[model samples]
Target: MSRDEQLRRAAYEEMEKHKDVVEKDPYRLHYHLMPTVGLLNDPNGFIQFKGTYHVYYQWMPFKTGHGAKFWGHYSSNDFVNWTHEEIALTPSEWYEKNGCYSGSAIEHDGKIYAYYTGNVKDEEGNRETYQCLAISEESLHFDKRGPVVHLPDGFTAHFRDPKVWEQDGAFFMVVGAQTRELKGAVALFRSDDLENWDYQGVLTGGGEGRLADFGYMFECPDLFPLGERDILIFSPQGIEASGMKYQNVYQAGYVAGQFDSATGTFEHGEFEELDRGFDFYAPQTTLDDKGRRILFAWMSVPDQNEQDHPTIEHKWLHTMTLPRELKLVDGKVRQVPLEEMEDLRVGPAIQVNVELNRETRVLKAVKGKAFEMEITDLSMTEGWFDLTVGDGIRFVYSSGEQTVTLERKSYVNGVVEKRQCSVKQLNSLRVFVDTSSIEVFVNEGEETFTARFYPSPNNDTVRFETSHQAVFTIRKWDLKHVNLK
Candidate 1:
């Protein structure tokens, strides 16, 4: 066998040895694709090709830490149900000897083309990167195309995560880059045959010195046309906490503005954090054949210590959030769960449209780990309302103060705890309740809190109490049972 074949077989053998432990992991989600073992980060090569949605991720199969990265593949017919495919590309080939890092996928004619970043470290341990390509005519078996485009000038080796799309009979790509001066920026390139690329120029850069540096280098830069505006999403590494945003160790956010393909320059405004949570990064977008832009985020962030994760004992490191539909409305983007999730509603959901009486309402007829609730405010003298979801977990939406705060007591069974995000207004609220988590999206994605809770199954009751007379329209849907892959 060739050396590449030997390395592939060895990596596959390592993954096979841990199958039992991976399957027995207790922290696995019911529906999301998780690492059977080791660390999984950065949703790479996300695309819907040949009628199936393919999602590849950064995987290190041997241990629960980031080491010897490879591309792990999973496909879905409905986006809700996923099937694990064979490993797409291991770091066995000469081009990707160190690791095959994050990149996007594209469907050309009838074949699926995967473009990723190849990592190589020389004897001195100096890092070298190449934006590489591989193709799969059958969508399962792949043919390595080798490194199609070498790194252009005026940038450091921090360049990676290529996002490609077709426009006006030509293909375009945006890569996260850092200048020799250590400034964060994104580089744009144009291609016709997907082999040779012409470097355009710096798409965005030099905002507020290195502090607004967000990071010394922006990783996973994604730019796609959304409705009337263009959205550029990236992971900025060195952002400091100025006020409400950028409080996390790292920030995965987007800047909305206009893109000029002719000049390869994007003039965008301030960056907005996509998901205000403990875990969110390297988000990528793909437009379905129908033209709707859908997004998936890396649900695990690099925070605290590797061993501090509660799910470490389970062997896997991370999972992705539910698929969300992105719609640009009135210049801002709004994210809502796809309609396919509605099929998860099992029992008859009870939705009440009523006028408030200033008194608390305690309804014990319904309770579950997976549920969706939509609350619409009709009119209220007092703007504050409390949504109590068992125990001391209270979601306070104060319209008068224009802030929404989520407070939890004994949250996540004392395993994980957090108090994050403040949204404005109480007009409309959607709450997703999971077995050990609660995700609240206020005013249609204006602000979101992806958080965890650990209450007894018996205490899953949802109650509502108000400060004054306020009319409300409540719609509830019990999510379909998920057999988490």
Candidate 2:
């Protein structure tokens, strides 16, 4: 076998040896994409080819830390069910001896061309990043074409994660970079063919003009047009927590406004976090065949208490968030689970339109590892109300404060932790609960908080209580598993 084939074989062997142990973890999400053995990070190379949707992610098969990463592949005919595919790219090439870092993919002339950053570290521990490509006809086998775009001047070697897209007959790439001054920036590149590339200029961010001194480095910069406006989605490092936002070690948000293709310039509004959650980072989107922009994000944060996750003890860690459909409402991005989730519904769900007073109400059919809940007509939820899921997670909303908070016991310690977001109203709340994670879409995706929490296994009871008189309707579902094999 070739070196890449040998390396891929070894990684798969390692994962198979520990698959049973990892699968036994109670925190293993029932419906989400998770690492079979080691660690999973940024969702990369999300593209709908032919009729199948493929999602690749940064994965290390040996351990939970950020070791040398391979592009782990998963494919889905529909958005709900997925099948794990062969390891797409291995880090055996000299250009990517250290790791095959994050990038994008495109299908041209029936050939799927994968563009990614080949990460290398010299003996002195210095970093050398190469924007490389690998082409495949079957999408499973790849022939490496090294370094289409090399390191440019004016930036640090931290330049990586090339998100490429085709626009107006030419391919454009946006590389997340850190300037020599250590400010975050996105470098724009243009190419007629997939191999040769021409460097444009910085699109935005950095200590340039109005955005003087943004984050230290921006990772996974994706630029795409949304309706009348353009959206620039990226994960920026070194942003401090402001109130209830940016609490994670890093933040993945978007700047939606206008972009000039000729000049490679973008005039964007303020950056907004895509998901207000305990764990969300490095989100990527791809337009489906039906022209819907679908997203999948790493449901775990990096560096911030990575070892705290109890799943690592079982020889695996991390997952991809539920595939969400993206919508632009009032110039802001709105994300909700794809409607195909309804197809996963199995048993009869609870439907109740009742008034909730100060007492707690425990709905018998409103709880499961895989389920959906719709809560609406909350115009009179005057004070704090708690929607408790089992023993751990609690969705608390204070209409008096116009804020929603998700509080749960920390995985490492039992200490209570919270992630809060401000909302103007509490007209509705749609929740999707999968084994260990919960995604809350408030007021039709106006605000959201996604999180991973470890409730006691088999304790599937959902309870809700109000501090005062609150009238709401609740529709709940018992969902079936989307088998990932």
| Most TM-score-accurate candidate | 2
Model 2: lDDT of residue 469 = 87
lDDT per prediction?
0.76, 0.87
Looking at candidate 1, what is the lDDT of residue 383? 61
Model 2 Cα shift for residue 65 (angstroms): 1.4
Instruction: Kindly list the per-residue Cα lDDT of model 2 for residues 1-485, writing each as its tens digit.
Output: 98887888899899889988887887887788988889999998999888899999999988888967899999988767889998999899899999999999989999889999999998898999999999988788888989999988899999999998898878899999999999999999999987899999888876885455668999999888777889999999998888887888899889998888777778888889998888888999999889898888998788878898888889988888888888998899999888777777777768888678788998776778778899987657468787998787999889789888999998888999999899877888889898888889988888878888888997989998898988888888877776688
Model 1: lDDT equals 0.76
RMSD of 2: 1.3
Clashing pairs in 1: 30-484, 31-484, 214-238, 214-239, 215-237, 215-238, 344-479, 344-480, 412-454
Candidate 1 root-mean-square deviation in Å: 3.2
